[model samples]
Structures are given as structure tokens and as C-alpha cells.
Target: MSQNDALHGDDLEKSGEALIEFIKSSNAESVLRGARGKLQEFFDHHIKTKKTTTDILNDLVHAEEGIGQKLVNLEGKKSQMMQEIEEIEQELQRNLSRSQILDSELEFLQKELERLRDAEQEIQTMQQEVDQDTTEVIPSAIYVAQLYCNVTKIKLELDTEPHILRGVYYGGDVAVPINMDTSTRSPCEVSDELWSLVNTEW
Candidate 1:
């Protein structure tokens, strides 16, 4: 209020009469409780279609509290989500490593198969040459005996061989000792007649 608005005494009679007349015409209420707000056009302010801070439910404060709880929940789950992502990354890396190893193994196997096919073709060609020329043979009696022993072993393991060793074909089953060396049998162990026959045939 201005100095004249709070005129007190008959000493300022004219100012006091003017203030009193203004208060009577205004009919303003006395402020007995808390503080009073500044005068303004209050109707123009709240006449619009919008809620203020003092709305019925205090909705702004409630919404703030709700958002705070949601933020706390999100923060709590962040580490768990990060751990799950790491686990997925590790699994993907492990599978990729295994796939690379499998691809390498398959590549090596294909190359080895091609090499084995070439070796087989070379062996067949050499065998045909040896069959055509008997003079080209390397004659070793010990080698012949070892070859015979190996043939016998292969026939035994085949299980469907109608012909095994020469004399042990359809008769008694020959049981070989497990620990003995089958290739160690010398050509001298054979009878003289069989040795002569082998020398002539071979």
C-alpha cells in the first residue's frame, strides 16, 4: 500500500476520508489467517480450461512419484540386461569358432581324399606294369613269406573269405595266438617242396 492508503488519524482528515470511502466501495475481506496474496485479475487467470498445481488430486506430484519408481525399477534391471547381452555375445562367438574349425577340418579332408585317389591310381598303374614283366620283380624270400602272412591275416579278418591260406581253406579253423608276430615266420620254416613250388610260381 502507498503512504496515503494506510492513513491513520484525523490529522490527515482528507486522506483518511478518501481511504475509508475506497475501502467501503471495494468491500474487500479482512485477512485474519495467513498471508494475503497480491491483487490481480484472478478470474482471467483460472477462467481458461487448464488445471493448476492445487488441482483436486495433486496430479503433478503423484505423477512425479510414479516416474521416480519406474526409474528405480529400470536402474535395478540394467545390470541383469547387460549380463544377458554378454552371455548372448559369448555364445555367438563360441559357435562361430566351432563353425570355423569344422570348415577347416572339412577342407583338409577334401584335399586328403583327392591325394588318396591319386595315390590309388598310381598304385594301380605300377601293379599293371609289374604283372606284365616278371623280370622286373624284386625277389626276396623273406618278403614273400611276410606277404603270405599278411594275406592270411587279411583273409581271417574279412570273415567271408571262402579261401584262406592254401591248406587251411575249408577244413579246421586256424587259431593264431594274439601276441605272436605273424610276419616273423621265415621261408626256412616251410618244407623244401613248398619252398621250391613258391620259388617257381613267384
Candidate 2:
């Protein structure tokens, strides 16, 4: 029984009857004394055991609470990590999209460059053909005639004796005169190829 029950309950009457029996019976005194000593030892050990059990139970409860708090903290950290992972995935997708756009732009620029190179090659080929045609058009005879007339006019103007060449013509165009007085001169004669060179655009 608990200490409170032994002090306040019907244990008092039972305790008195046991004391009377112990005095009336022969050789019961020594046996009762020994039993009382043993009972006291039992109560002392029980109380010690109960206190130790209570302390252990309290320690277990505190340990459980600590473990619960740690679990909650771990769950929060896991949630934050998941959120970070999601953000990283989104950033990677954005980078991939930008890379695709750059690839498309690069492809377009490459096509434009190829087209420009082709056009430049065509223009160079056409220019070469025009140059070849121009080289074949001017005749050597027309070039010599123009040069002879130009030299004769320069010599005539620089000569101190102008009267000595008034009636004679040494070097001049047979059809078109080198002088500005060309009223009585014939029309200039030129090769058909030279005429095309002076008149044609290409």
C-alpha cells in the first residue's frame, strides 16, 4: 500500500490486531520482529525502484521530443532543397532556349554570307568578260593616227617661223585636219571596233 493509505485508511485497525496477536502467541515475537525487518527492507527497495522507473520514463519522454524536433527540421530543409532544384531546372531550360535561338541566327547569317559570296563571284566574272571585249575593240591604226595629229599640231604652234609651213602640211589627219578651221575637211574615218569602244557602255 502507498504511504498515504497506510497513514489514513483502515490499515490502522489491521495493524492493531496484528500487534495483539504477536503478544499473545509464544515464539511469535522473534518471528514477527524478523518479518517486520524484512518488510521494511522490501518497502525501502520498492520505493527506490519506483523513483528510478519514474526518472527513466521522464528521460525517455524528453529524448522522444528531441527526436521529433530533429525530424521536423529535416523536413523543412528537404522542402527548401526541392525548391532550389526546381529553380535550377527552370534556369537550365531558359539557357537551352537561348542557345537554340542563337543557333538559328547563326544559320541565317551563314546563308546570307554564302549568297553574297556567290553574287560577288558572278560580278567578277562579268567584269572580266567586259574587259576582254574592250581590249579587242581599239585598232592600232586609229591610235597611231590620233597620236600623229596631236604631235603635228603641237610642233606647228611652237615653231617660230609660221610662214614656212603656211602652204605645206607635214603631219595631220588626212580626213579631219588638226586645225580648228575644219570647214573644208572630210569626215574622220575610224575602224568599226574603235567606234564601238567610244560609243558603247561596256
Candidate 3:
């Protein structure tokens, strides 16, 4: 090979080995990172020098900065999402507390409703007894008159008169008569003492 060609080959080999070392090292400054990109551009320029190696290196450096900025933005989004989740969890706890209070009130209301139902059943039984004692029906007027005899402390008597029937009817026609005593008596007079005793009773 010519001396110039040999010297260029040695420079390429040294640049390649330096680039491998830079990539392996964890400590890379922005300038050194840009230099690493410039090495790839330098290789491409040696093959075909349409664009300058420096311009390609600067573009790659800007792209890396953009990627880092996007990572920071994603981290911010993750923090916001975590905060929202915490707020929702707090709301759920508040709702659970309200539900527990409502459950307690519902249980109390159910017990009260059951007590009212029992009271209503008892009232219905008492009303039925009052109705049974107050009213009665009689089969005939004679039976009705007999009931007043027990209540008013007066006796009632009936009189009968017989008449012969002509051929218009085959039986004798009898006239029924009733007598009522002028004097009547009731069980008790209207009095405050009697009303007081009735009102205080169950």
C-alpha cells in the first residue's frame, strides 16, 4: 500500500477502537456523546461525503435530548396518575362510611316498623270485642220487646182476643196485645264518678 493509504487505515482503526471504549464507559458528557455520533458520520463520510459528518452528529445529539425529555414527560404523567388513584381511593372510603351509617338507620327503622305492626294487630282484636258486646239482632218484635224488659227494669205482658172467622178463612183470627209499664229504670244515672272510672280503664 501507499504511505498515505496506510496512514488513513491506521487512523480509521484507532477511531473505531476509541468509539468502542466510549460506548463501554458509563460516563459520557453531552459533548462526548455527540463525538460518538460523529464517529459513525465520519465512517459514512469516508464512504460517501454527501453530507458533512458534523451536521449528522449534531442531529443525532438533538434526537437523544428529545428522547430524554420524553422520558421526563412520561415520569410526570405517571406521578399525576398515581395522585388521581389516591383521590379515588379516598372517595371510596367516604362512601363506605356513609353506607355503614345508612345500614344502621335502616336496621332501626325496621325494628320500629315491626313494633307498629304488632300494635295494629292488638288494636284490631280489641275493636272486635267491643263490636261483639254492643249490638245484637232479634228474630221478632216480641223478642226485641223482651230485651228491653231486662235492660229498663220493667215487665211487658201480651193480651190475646179470639174472633170466629166466616167461610172467608178457616181459622180463628186472634188480636195480639202488648202492655208497657209507665215507670222505667236504667242501671245508673249520668255521674262524674262513673265517667272517671270508665276513662281510666284500659
Candidate 4:
């Protein structure tokens, strides 16, 4: 009806024709098919990558568990070794104490042995002196007995009685026994050489 309205209707008709032509072209169809192919490729790659990451994470978890178990075993071994070392140290200390005790006992035993040897030597020396005194007394008593027999015209007999030297003077129907004390007080005091000769003759 109006000229302006007629012109607007013609412009709208041209715009709709241009849009229909652009949608029906080969380039638009090719673009749509390429976009669809790219979307499929992206989804496939995402699925593959997710599977790979999950497998890797599972492997890492298993490795960590193995490492933890090894650490626990090592800790147990360390505790065992420490206990053995402590026991060894205690045994060593006990052995050292026993060695010290043994050394002290050995020292005491050596001292006792030395004392016993010294006492034995002292006893031997005293016994030798006593034997020499007894030998001298016997000869002196016999000499006194002989001198008495010569003066009194009796018989003199010399012998050992009860581990001592005895001189028996035999007179007429009488027998008198003379000991060491009687010889020392007798008038005839014989010399050492004469006593030695008497011992040699006997």
C-alpha cells in the first residue's frame, strides 16, 4: 500500500534468499563435517590418556607399598642387631670381672706357696742343729762313762735307749745308768777330738 513498506518487504525477501543460499553451499557442509571429525578425535585421545594415567597411578601405589614393607623389615633387623650387641657387651664385662678375680686368687696362692717353702727350710735347719747336739752329747756321755769305769774298776756299756745315748756303769752286783746331764758335771771333760774319735770307732 505505501512505498516505504513496499521497499522494506523487498529487502527482507533478499536477506532470506542470501541466508538460504549460504546454508546450502558445499563449503558450509565441508566445514561442519571437519568439526565433527575433530570432536571425535579429541574424545578418543582423552579416553586413552585417562586409562594410561590410572594405570600409572596404580603402579606407583603398589611400589610405595613395597617400599614401606621393606622399611619395616629393615627396622626389625636393626632392633635384633642392637639387642645382640648389648648381650655381647654384657658377656665381655662378666669375663673381665672373672679374669680379675682369677688373677687375685693366683697371686694369693703364690704367696702362700712361698711362705710354705720358707717354713720348710727353717724346720730343716733346726732339725740339723738338734741332730748335731744329740750326736755331741752321746760321745761326751760315753767318754765320762769310760773314765768312771777306769777309776772305779767297773765295766762301762754304751747304747741308745729311747732315742738318747745311755751309759751303764756295771759295778759289783750294781748297775747305774748315766745320762747327758751327769756327763756335763763329771770331772773328766773330754776334748772334741776325742769325742770324734769315739764316734768314728763306734
Candidate 5:
């Protein structure tokens, strides 16, 4: 109730008039003392058993304050986690970029290795062909040299058997016996077989 509102209304007036009449009809002092006793007892009962609105409201406010503190702590933790997540994402991106560069380099190296392998195979094939050509050409060249030496009447002995040279020059090739031996030339490195074929003792 506001302070401006009247405390007593029409009911209070009638009740007062009746009470005054009763007091005059009976012992007024005794009635007044009994009413005071009843009021005091009622106040004492209310103070002991019932909680006030103010006290309940204060309890609720304390609980709310505790909850608010917990919320603040959680928010701080969440902020730290978010910052850590951002750093991890940045690091992941850098690793992805580095991985991409390594993948490209690996691919290039693989191609270079394949090319080198193919070149090695080609070189082996050329070497085999050169070896085949040398085998077929050597004996024919010796035969030609024998024909030339025989026609010029040059007597060239060799470390090999005489019959072998005779067969190479005369076996269905020339009508007469022939001989030839190639010696090492100056400023040139020659094979051991060629050098040994020259009969130096003869």
C-alpha cells in the first residue's frame, strides 16, 4: 500500500463504534489487554515459522550470480580453443601447399628416370649392332689384305698357323697361296691380337 492511501475506511469506523459500545458495556481495560496479547502472539508465530519475501529474493540473486561466473569461465575457455583451432587450420594449409609441391617434384623425377632408362636401352642396342658389324668385317678385310700382298709378291709371315692363312686366301678365293700380317702403326693404340699376329721372330 502507498503512503498516500487512507489506512482506515468505512469498515474500520463501524468496527470502532461497535468496539467502543462493547467496551462501555463490559470491562474496557481487560478487553484492551487481551487484544494486545493476541497481536503479540501472532507476530511471534509469523517470525518463527514463515520465511519473508526479501530473504527468498536474496537467495535467488546469489544463485544467479554463481551461474553468471561459471558462464564467464566457459566463455574464456571457448575463446582460447577457437584461437588454437585457427592456428591449426593455418598450419594445415601450409602443409597442404608443401605436399602439393613435393608431389609435382616426384612426378617430374619419375619421368626423367623413365627417359634415362629408355636411353640406356637404346645405347645397348647400338653397341650390339656395332659388335656384329665388326665380327663380319674383320675376316673379309684380312682376305683383301692377303690378296694385295700376294699380288705384290710381299712375303709376310704370321704367328698363326700357315694353313689358316692359306685357306683364307686360297680356299675357293684365289688360285695361289697368299700371306699378310698387319703391324701396329705409330701414334695409334692397337689390339693385343693384332700385335701378336706379326711374326717378329721371322
Candidate 6:
């Protein structure tokens, strides 16, 4: 209950009468001054609250601008990173293509080398066969002379098996074997007279 509500009967009447008397005796200037002071306090409190609100709004605006700038920078970086990733991917593709081409070239080279090796082996085998045949059938000196006469078109005389000569002749009725060293001589070491005789006969 209020204090006014607690008062009753003569107490309420006396309080009412005293309040009326106080109101009548109060100075007009003092009453106006008191109201002005209260109004000033209320306006001061309102202005202070409005200034705090304006400061908070300014701070919020600055924070928003900072966040926007940061977002723009991050976006730029993201774009750059994306472009780099694309470049790297393109480079990887090119390298893979080059590697594939190199692999194909290597495969072709390896096949060519194998074919050449096979051809070389065939040639060696044929050469060995020819050598074996030549070893088995030795040519006679008369056959060799006939061959030189046919190929070189020169009437060359040669001895049997061992001492084959180009131009020298040993006149005998019967076959007499002469014991001499049968080593082969280079054409460069042969006498010029022999070569001249062969050319003249030809």
C-alpha cells in the first residue's frame, strides 16, 4: 500500500490541507527555476544518449568498410590462385603429351634397332656359308689362271698349288716340282715388269 493510502480520516485531510497551503506559499520564480533545471537535465541526458548512438553508428560504418576491403582483396587472391591452377594444369597436359610422343619415338627406335640387328645376323650367316664353301673346294692353279684370263683378259701362267706366279714361266717337258717358299706376296711388292708384261699381254 502507498504511504498516502496508509493515511486515513483526519491524517489525509490534514496532509491535503498542508499541501494546499505549501503550494500557495511557494515562490513563482523558484518553482519556474526548479522546472527549468529538471528540463535541462532531461535534455542533457537525451543529447548524451544521441551522441553515443552516433559514435556507435560511425564505428559500425568503419568496420563495414574494412570488412568490404578485406573481402575484395581475398577475392583478388582467389582469382589469381585459380588462374595459376589453370596454368599448371595446362603445363601438366603439355608435358604428358610430350612424354607420350617421346615414348612413341622410343618404341619406334627400338623396333628399328631390332630389325637392323636381324638383318646383320642374316648377312653374317650368309658370309660364313660362303667362307665354308670356299674352304671345301680349293681352286687349282690352272683354273685360277683360266679365271684371271677370262676376267682380266690376260694369258697368265701359274704353277700348280704352291707357287703361283703372274708372268714367270718355267719351260719343262715333264712336271718338275721346285721346292721354294710358297708364301703369298702383296701386289705392291711384285715387280713392275710383271705388271707391265700382264698389261701388254692383255
Candidate 3: segments with Cα more than 4 A from true spot: 1-53, 132-202
Candidate 6 Cα outliers beyond 4 Å, as residue runs: 1-24, 129-202
For all candidates in order, the CA lDDT equals: 0.55, 0.62, 0.59, 0.67, 0.62, 0.66
My TM-score estimates for the predictions, one after another, are 0.36, 0.45, 0.35, 0.48, 0.40, 0.49
The Cα error of candidate 1 at residue 88, in Å, is: 2.8
lDDT per residue for candidate 3 within 93-150, as digits (tens), equals 9999999999998987787678657656765665566458757753566554444333
**Candidate 6 deviation (Cα RMSD):** 22.5
What's each prediction's clash count?
0, 0, 0, 0, 0, 0
Over 57-145, each residue of candidate 1 has an lDDT whose tens digit, in order, gives 57877888899999999987997899999999999999999999999989987976787676567656655766677675566654444
Q: lDDT tens string, model 4, 78-196?
A: 99999999999999999999999999989977986786576567656655766677655556566555544443444434445443334544443566554444444433543332232
- TM-score head-to-head 1 vs 4, winner: 4
Ranking by TM-score: 6, 4, 2, 5, 1, 3
Against the true structure, whose TM-score is highest?
Answer: 6
Task: Give the 10-residue window scoring lowest on summed lDDT in candidate 3.
Answer: 163-172
User: What ranges in model 1 sit over 4 Å off?
Assistant: 1-61, 133-202
Q: State residue 107's C-alpha deviation in candidate 4, in Å.
A: 1.7
Mind sharing the TM-score for model 4? 0.48
lDDT accuracy of residue 95 in candidate 4: 95
Candidate 2 Cα lDDT to native: 0.62
Off by over 4 Å in 5: 1-25, 41-51, 122-202
Give the root-mean-square deviation of each candidate in angstroms.
Answer: 15.7, 23.1, 25.3, 22.4, 23.0, 22.5
